[model samples]
Target: MLSTKCPNACIRACHLPAWQKAEEDVKSLLKEKLLPALQRASLKAERARIHNVIGQISGE
Candidate 1:
């Protein structure tokens, strides 16, 4: 059973048994590894964008 607090993204899995196991495995990976890597990549990309903008403003 899923609580009302469940994220909208995960709501489907709660109603579908076929998706439940795969969802759990993916969630574990996201917690243990994938989410951190994704966050790091996002930060790196944002940093690069900021640097580029600054360089353009400064005529680098």
Candidate 2:
């Protein structure tokens, strides 16, 4: 068995087979879930910045 503490806690949380499965799960979630959420948040921030710039230009 492999185990460690500190920053390696994440790595130590799984053995070989479990790690492989977890890697796939994490990849799937990042691609299907996290990426979309991040994209939406980024778009919102960009829109807010554009709105702020427009407001400044209009002297509001």
Q: Which tens-of-lDDT digit does each residue in 2-43 have in candidate 1?
A: 323335533332344433444445444545544677775665
**Which residue pairs clash within candidate 2?**
none
Q: State TM-scores per candidate.
A: 0.40, 0.40
| Alpha-carbon lDDT, every model | 0.45, 0.46
Clashes of 1: 0
Question: Candidate 1 versus the native: TM-score?
Answer: 0.40
Model 2 worst lDDT run, 10 consecutive residues: 5-14
- Residue by residue across 1-60, what tens digits does model 2's lDDT show? 232334454332224455455445554454554467766566556555444433443342
| Candidate 2 accuracy as TM-score | 0.40
